[model samples]
Target chain A: MTLSEKNLKNEIYDFKKFYHLIKAFTISTNISCKAFNLNGEKIASFKGPESDTSFCKLIQKLNQEKNYCMQSYIYGGQQSEKLGEAYIYFCPYGLVNWTVPVIKENKVRCFLTAGPVLMHEVDNLLVENAVKMCPMLDKRRKEIKSKLSKIIVVDTIRVKYLADLLLKLAKIIMAEDAVDLNNKHELNIFNAHLVENINEIKRTYTLQGKNNKISNFQEKEANLITKVTSGDKEGAKKSLNQFLGYIFFYNADNIEIIKCKVIELMIRLLQVVTEVGVDYNVVSGIKYKYLKNLINAGDFNEISKNILEVLDYLIDCLTPLINVKNRNTILIAINYIRNNYHKDINLEEVAAQVGLHPVNLSKMFKKETGKKYTDYLNEVRIEASKNLLLRDDLPLVQVAFSVGFNDQSYFSKIFKKIEGVSPNKWRVLQKEQKNFN
Target chain B: MDREILNELTVALQKGDAIKTQKFVKIALKKGYEPEQILTEGLVSSMNTIAEKFKKKQIFVPDLLLATRAMNAGIFILKPKLKKQLFSPIGKVLIGTIEGDLHDIGKNLVKVFLERAGFEVIDLGNDVPVNYFIEAIKKFKPQILGLSASLTTTMYGMRDVIKALEKEGLRENLLIVVGGVPITESFATGIGADIYDMDGTKVADKAKEKLKCSNF
Candidate 1:
């Protein structure tokens, strides 16, 4: 599904609402429930009063690893669709679970699962097989055996009835959500139209003109392109912004024309970088695609932002090929920083490795790289930390320590100062953006 | 009937106090005020004020959203009562964010404005597939269809939906309006859309204009 579709689904099947609904149901019925997308990714789950059964957890873990639960959901979805009702069956764990496919326009969009209810006495043979399948369960043998004894049993007819009732309730909730969304949309449009009319009136009187200083514009653009090809990112960024400012000021009335001019500028910049030995494939691949996106940009601000990103990419791509006077020393220092960022290494050690005095090395680094030694080291560490943060398995403190910051608080403080958000928030944003994209 | 109670209800709605709005709605109903009177004077009047404030830049998106919530709180109570009376809408509209686009805040805002303008709106929700749009058009038989897409990649879906509508021989029957971050007037014209707006704020007026032109 597209990001918009996922968002709509999210809005329709509100997580908090579903969580509370399932929680309330669990409280009343002692039946745990979970919702999953078509991919079997658990959207939300609620634990019932009976959820702490050790045996159930073990079986669930095993089932997750083997994808037995997801398989059952898929099978159940097929059955539910075919029969035009919810599908209920005994899982491999010998507990009854029901799956309801939320069908829209003949497509199964999501599934609701409610179960792990024992319809009969727990069989000892099933337990033995589960234990054998997972030897780790041997350590919890006594706990599992005891929990197994406490398993509640219900009649098949009652279980089926409860499943059917829950499915109907889920359907009703979804329908109501649709109505609520429609209502909200209507209200928003009503408010927005009035604002738009006033803005349109104000815009009608705004004056716009073209800059007659087009004589030097091309020369200045060429210089900026040259800077990007030489890997002068800071210079290129400054020039790009100045050019955008000129475009915005002069062509404010005609966004489409400005968009066209910006695309032309980007293409010229790409050609210059490619001429400077940046791979043709890389430039060609992104140039037209980025140009298309730039052309489709909504307004001056969006177009300028896209152009800036393009310039940044060009500079990054050309940086390795740009020949610097102190390339050897800087490369050695950079290599050392990359390799030992996780350890306590000072500028003195790095300078000594490069056979230069610390003061001379620091000055040389700043002059050549446009950043101080400490800042450069921090950038390298921060970059490393970003990679570590991408892995959901790693805790924030571990990520900090793994990237050489012994103090998690200091690490988080530095991260926020650099990234504009806390480490955990950044991780979450990255994950959410990654999921949607 | 005390006019002050209706005034208080309007204030609650403007303040986005859902609980207070609901309370005042009940109070107005209990005071023997007709449901239609309460809706027009209490809820709709507050919404109009909000819309004007929004137009003058005195309030923004969050404020608009909250005010809408407040109005809905009152509307929910009045809906059942108003059902007993004849409450004909201006026209019906079907709206959705196109498939592969997850942006609906804009679309939702449009839906709200159209409804407030007395149009009966059927929102298909975001990331709606082309076939679903076709199916909805056929089922709702709306006077207008609004398609929204925020991403360049997904904006193509709007054109696809338009094409699908034409394929189903349903294109000429209804007015097609397209909007979103990436949608341009030129793009809309190229795709044979009847109207295009940059945002939801102007959609209601544009829809009204289209309806007038089509004599619907």
Candidate 2:
């Protein structure tokens, strides 16, 4: 459903109760939050009586140009909207803040920006930069310092956790009128880190030489069916790319020949994935959608891109069945992790949801998944973040924050420790690899 | 023989010190350093370090572009000297952005990458129409033609150029490599392009491989 159908102003029936709810949030977390409409006017802001955030309000009240703060908020909101999540960033005043966009009909109708906390120690340089916009602050340096000290010092991990919670919180405040606000599920681009596999296919095609004919189709289809049934979605897609690459290579000048081959292959795949044991209508729905796509495909290149999308959809439809049928606790937990890895989900919460003690969950998870819970979650987040890195328009910080990392520095450190190169460098390396033979 | 001068040159380049880097290159040349030695040690090695630093996030894009400018300046002082040596260009490449697209920074980067890899490049610049490409291809008869387009609206211009080349019977021996923001392998092949590479730094390698395997 489109977000405008449930719009922002219609979300809550009672403002007093909502204000108290947001106030409770501040009391527990020691962070201040303000929600704003599209025109840059405040809709709701709750300040806990126990803590003070006169620092930012004082800046807006005293500053010459009030638009800088709003501009930063706008920029941050645009970024979060792009990534489909909350974006944690350092504001112009060097305070850690996050913006979560509540989009409606593709426009940000409202947004919530939270946090003015200190991640690092406040210093003279930071204080000077913070108040440089106001000449009256020349005498108020001491006052600013004391107020900055009053701001809470938060760790990056806790910041990310709170921001993840705040994302849901923002949507909750905006979606109260809708039947289901969580329907906007993001598909995991299943061919995660397929750089090596894509190149391998190219190398194999080159090694197969221009003169060698694919004398038979049975061997190739068998190879793909093995991957698909074994739940190796990436391997299945790799086989598909390899299969399509050969067709395109051999028939570069003939679109009709390649289309004929793709149609024959799609008929075979319809039989293979149909065995997944979902309902008849569901399988038929998947069949109708994919068949229509392939039939409407314009060229061999279109087929190459769409077939991967088909695999992603089919896997999305079928994997739930596999997980639900198993009813294995470890498998269930892993499935849960895969679905929610983009959020700040922790072992304790997953354990609670799955009805296991935290310690047992940790032990069983390690024994089953062959890694610690944290490692697996981090790897999942890292794999997903790798997809975002390929887009040059995205900043390193936003990719980190969108994938549940709070600090760009820490993201780089972890990325290097895991991927052996920094994120941007890894991107450059991937682009350097030959994509087509 | 002061090897330390090359070290100083590298530091200057990484710092994006264009004047100091050129000064060091001229000084190194006057100190009787071989032109090949100065090119590799003072210029190429510094660009390599910048790439390495960028990969490690020790520096960022502004730093990288600044260092690239510094290295380009050093190359300005060193190119004529290198021509005196036995080293030579490996092949010819004709490149341009398609019509209605004014973006050329990516095209320029690919040009730099191809030049550094020793392919002689004849740049037709940006917003180029079809006939200019055909005329250049006929004149230069380069081994590869690189077509770039940043906008979806203009990317189809690459296809139009390829079709025009085929109509003129010039598509037989030429390899067409397509790239830019909107140009994917699918779009490349959809338009009958021979290769699609997004990375400027490695397009030269693909060109070299194609050249090696071809009759030319």
Candidate 3:
């Protein structure tokens, strides 16, 4: 199916409101305008009452080339899409015509075509050109000239202004493109500086390197999964943002690749959190909704927001995993361990906090989360220590003590056991992967 | 040859960067590089790639227009320096989007490429009427006239301008180059144009060839 069919569902992409806006736009501008969907079908149009006998309508009616008008509009729209701006071109009838692509998430949702009107007066020379433009105009020269003279001649600059306004309207029309559409009217337009655009292109040109080997984000990905699994929502969000920025910069102008990367990233993140004894039905339900949202994401920023939203929800669901619904004592025990893992807290302390015996807490934690209580706490400390280890200022001994390990050698032992490499070696792998060129 | 700067300039121009193109041209100039080398190796070479991509749909018309603008930015810096060389300007060409035609992207691109090819081009911009072309031809006395119209309804405007040029007895030595979409080789002949380039990319070369052959 087409992109429009995939995303422009009635609930998500509103058309009724768009029709009203375009109608008002045409009436206010006093210019005849038509809108075409992504498939180039005429979705809606408005002919101001004053433009009933517009030169375009008469010319099309009189001419034998029936599809020429539509063809010209389609060409103008396609050019505007390719140009990424308003395309001002002449119509087949030698009249001023222009189109502005209504882009949602950098995809053309609709095209607003605004003309086929005369920019000049109906002078004798113009009439002569028209007379030769078509054989049907041979006998209708006087009428054609009279019809053209009656239409309002918009100033060239004002026509450009109208085109810009039409594009703004197009943006508004596509505001529903966001999954969370309530406050998403803050759309981007070329109403900003060209310098910013060039700089953006420049940065992407640098980051998109010859093959994106500038840096490997393996450590960052490990850092993020730890945050998610350990229920560090706030830290996970920061990591997610940084991770997305790196990937987006690394793969600019190649959004399909970025989207695929995001899909893989999000599924891995969800997998890490959902492996707990959360109900299978609930996990899949949330998974389906968020994955759909990610697939329908329009831009990198939107993709980031979509994944963050899911993270917020899944993490919130994590908070209540011990509630009256399941009375899940294991989650309470795990939450207690997450809070005190950086300190020298033990399973008895966590069991007492959740009002369970030490033996019961340990057994439930292992049964539900599939990890021993001590092993889970060590994983949390190791994940936390990984963050501190990414910095050079923090010495290894201090990193071990800060993450609740009593001795530096023991921190190294656990880190090596979980990661198959020492912390020092992991840092070297990360530091050495910076290929700036 | 400072091939590195030239390569970066090519990449910047291909990416449609005006400021970066200007920056590279200035850097090369300050480094004592020849303006001709920068023009041919940097601007013209990138534009040739753009034209090839445009034909293959790897890029679009707006990309070509932007690359042309960047090339123009480079030339704006290079024009004065180019006067020291003998290929500064071999001939003059008058070009426009023709009467009632508003699409100037194609026209601007051809103008910049011609200017880089050592031909001084006088651009009359969009919607230029037949008389303006006739008057510009009389005043500029260019060896060629390039008529560009991006729409079918208006491309035939070339015929009227050609007829007017012939009527004024200005077609004898003037090579009329008609271009734009919907303008095929047959249509070019039908419209009385001497050259029928789909795009005016090679009009400058054709103009030079005809000028040399006819000894105009």
Candidate 4:
């Protein structure tokens, strides 16, 4: 199941119990912390000594007004869970906020935000403007000013470390709660009810929007499907999100219309799958199952999640076919290396040409060709040098330089390593073989 | 002799408690249990269970590695005593990761599995030069030479080793087995290797098969 569908909000997390556990942590660290659901609703909080500072209050007010909390949630939540890292950013008020996503089942269910801690000396003017924005804090101006003087400035490294620690603790708590809920059928019912209520509100707003601006996303859809078929995972996700955004933009609050549009999109995707030569039965089964999930999806997120899952499955099915693209990349790299064997070439340059990380390219190069990047390059250069060496008068140093090597000694060393003889010995041996033939 | 101590040794090996396994072996030896009986019933039998679980996907790489360590600990204590026994290994095998490739996890797993299956394994370790492999084969006179290279770049090292053997006329004297993530059966065959196993557990079985076919 998708993480959002896990109903983590309904999982009986005792805020009082958690607050008690982390109260000392917040106080000692001088960092105020809060947890929020995916919808930007605060679930619980731990106020540190600096929390009541006028600057802190002003920053919180500005965040609510500017929707910075929601922005941070969206920004941090977008990072893939596989990376297992938290997103850190500075709020507009100049205080650093670290957003740690609590991911479950490979989806972010909630976020633990720790911050308003200064990463630098407090800026008085920014603090003044914050106070001006929230005039209700005028009475506490003297106290706020005093507190801002003692503002705790933490290093970015420490902030990140703490954020990771909180993330681990949150994961442990979630796991423990999930295990506890396994035996509680009544709690499951309550969680299902809570999810239904949340989904009901989403469905109501979804159906209320007008259907307009449904442009021809057909070209974009086809591009997205191509990316999926080619096993461009990151590219496919980006395109899918953009395509879904366009669909939601025009057909917001309309589940029935969105469902039909999604089904149409699926059919187009299925055609691509068939062209890729995935088993017919598997393709049909996936299409049927995805359609059922899409139609029954309660919210936009659910529908999007279902679509992404189907895309992921199709990408997996197309993995063997995707090797054709990898083969092309390897061929292109090989050609580049061979054509440029007379000059300098390295893994990084060739990797950039193929738009892959050097390490990944290195691994792929070895897997596809059974030769290391440098080894292949050396082989090409050595072969070229052999042809140059055939001439009776070509100097060995010039031969080395002509085939991309800077030093005759190094080139000779590699040549002997591969051919099991020095260049001069190889020349004499080749001539001997020639006379025998 | 208390049979319970042998059972405890098996459990300790399964749990990957190397020190505990060694202690239990010492206890079993002091209790007048035959070293061969302890080796087979306690250590090898536990590795067999672990291998079976690994095949069934009940355990993973880390678990197998730990179990191997515990089994090795128990076997280390029994090796001296086993030397005096009339224990003949099924075969001798020399193995190493090929030159310019430092990956050895796969090679180590294969070596451990082979040793567990009663083969005398001479591990040449990672980044072994082609000359080292040839020299080791000559010195060790092993029936099988296993070449492992995880990188695509170093896989050619396997081919080079095979060619070197052929050049020295030693190729016919030994069965060459090749393995690694990048070494498929086709790649092994292309390199003229006698056997290829994707899973390290099956390497021992393949080695045995090759030995039987050659009437070793």
How much is A270 displaced in model 1, in angstroms? 3.3
Task: DockQ each candidate and list the results.
Answer: 0.09, 0.03, 0.03, 0.01
Cα misplacement distance, residue B79 of candidate 3 (Å): 2.8
Reference-based TM-score of each model: 0.41, 0.44, 0.33, 0.35
Where model 4 places Cα greater than 4 Å from the true spot, the runs are: A1-116, A119-143, A155-165, A172-218, A245-258, A274-277, A296-302, A320-367, A370-424, A427-437, B1-216
Residues B1-216 of candidate 4: C-alpha lDDT, one tens digit per residue? 559999999998888777788899999999999876897688877887886786566764345555665676677788766542338988899999987665565686677667766789898987799999989988999999998976434666788899999999899869998887545554577668898865666888878887988974
A21-140: candidate 3 lDDT, tens digit per residue: 877887887777876776557665677657744666667676745667777777778766654566776565656767877656645666778765655455554576667766778888
Q: Of 3 and 4, which scores higher on TM-score? A: 4
Worst lDDT window (10 residues) for model 3 chain B?
B60-69
Per-residue lDDT tens digits for candidate 4, residues A112-213, read: 677766544444443554466556655766656676666677654576677666655565655654333232322222222333333333344356643323
Task: Considering only chain B, report the TM-score of model 2.
Answer: 0.65
CA lDDT scores, all candidates in order = 0.71, 0.71, 0.69, 0.70
| Model 2 lDDT tens row, A106-145 | 4566677787886555666458777676667888899999
Better of 1 and 3 by DockQ: 1
Candidate closest to the true structure, highest DockQ: 1
Model 4 chain A worst lDDT window (10 residues): A181-190
Question: What RMSD value applies to candidate 4?
Answer: 36.8
Off by over 4 Å in 3: A1-437, B29-37, B44-68, B83-92, B100-120, B138-143, B149-154, B179-187, B195-202, B205-209, B212-216
Docking class of 4: incorrect
Interface RMSD of each: 17.2, 9.8, 17.9, 23.4
